[model samples]
Target: MAKGKVGKTVGSLGDYLKEQRVGARLSLRQLADQAGVSNPYLSQIERGLRKPSAEVLQQIAKALRISAEQLYIRAGILSPDDGVGGSVELAILSDTGLTERQKQSLLDVYASFLALNAADGADDATPAGAENDAEGTAPITTEIDPDSDNRVTNEG
Candidate 1:
């Protein structure tokens, strides 16, 4: 990475960091303290005079209560595709109640479910009617029995 404020990407990253800090209503000194960085260094980063490392970016993201992946994308450490995840992933990542390990586990499970669904979709390329009409295939149907405590009952 180029140093000394010449890089446009670095400037944009710095601009984004400043925007986030301001949006969080944090002073430069306060943000620096929360991010465990020096005020001068943080100011230099905001001014595009220096490009921060991924670790520093993560600290800043935590301080700003934002996604570290967003910071990584802004800093050119991760591509948009690499950081791509919908609201569920964002919620999981942003949930402060979960430990890092628990968050990672949940994310892993969610990714696996997505992959499984995608594979199933790919395998459904046959003619639409043929899918359910194939031999040994049955469409499972469920109904909530009013008589029973709303328990789901499998019909076919």
Candidate 2:
């Protein structure tokens, strides 16, 4: 069978790899260990100083716990749907070392942070209420139910 053509785009593969690595908050050494590749080699690949073979890409995808197709698409080796937006956050959450439960936990924390920030912003935008305590602080209490998912039960 004829070999498929690889992308000649400048730094496309390297950029993709680097982005994925950073998104996962992984160091070069960690990715190297997981991918069974040397740290120097992965570094060179991320710098566009080296080209990796298809077998190496497969290993990387396995280590990253993502589909080979996704890696191929990122590497410019395959074309996939461009309709769905790609998320660096999601890529990070997909790391092999992370369990589904851990990812959910991280997502829940992030959501709560966002909610708190939004609430603060809203308070700042509104006029001061007479109910403001002696410290002139708006009391917002977040209650978390152990049985429930990260949905906040507002005690306000």
Candidate 3:
């Protein structure tokens, strides 16, 4: 992978990993041991000082008892939009670490955002003429006078 791509997400990935590790109540050494990596390396990963490989991410995910796909996405190894529609929902649903209630909550929020966007788009979809002629007024007509200097003339 290009350094630029990994650089863009390494900090975010590190932060997420640290949060997950803390939530799991595991020490850095413990996680490193479980993931079969050295303590310093794991620390570097957590501190955003180093970008981990996909294999390392998978191992860490296994150690943390979370979905490898989630780590993959965080690490920029896999795109959240890898599939088609509902990819975000799929990622949330597939995470082994989140409870059913948490997953449902996330799904609800996503649906709400989508609905809001659709509603806003609907408001913008009103016909331009409809708004101008809401009072049942005819549209203005204009014509060019052939006998004059080609000036515009309103035809009532």
Which predicted model would earn the best TM-score? 3
- Residue-by-residue lDDT tens digits, candidate 2, 30-109: 99999999999998888776767545777887887767666656654333543343353345354668765675466557
lDDT of each: 0.78, 0.67, 0.80
lDDT of 2 at 52: 75
**Count of clashes, each model:** 0, 0, 0
Which TM-score value belongs to model 1?
0.50
Clashing pairs in 3: none
**What residue runs in model 2 are displaced by over 4 Å at the alpha carbon?**
1-10, 80-156
* lDDT per residue as tens, model 3, 9-97: 89889899999999999999999999999999999998888988656787899999998778877876555764564578667766778
Candidates, ranked, TM-score: 3, 1, 2
Model 2 scores worst on lDDT over the 10 consecutive residues at: 1-10
On the 0 to 100 scale, the lDDT of residue 156 in model 1 is: 53
Show the lowest summed lDDT stretch of 10 residues, model 1: 77-86
Better of 1 and 2 by lDDT: 1
Best-fitting candidate, scored by lDDT: 3
- lDDT, candidate 1, 1-80, per-residue tens: 45543477778988999998999999999999999999999999998888786567778999999989888667654447
Q: For model 3, what is the error of residue 77's alpha carbon versus the real structure, in angstroms, after optimal superposition?
A: 0.8
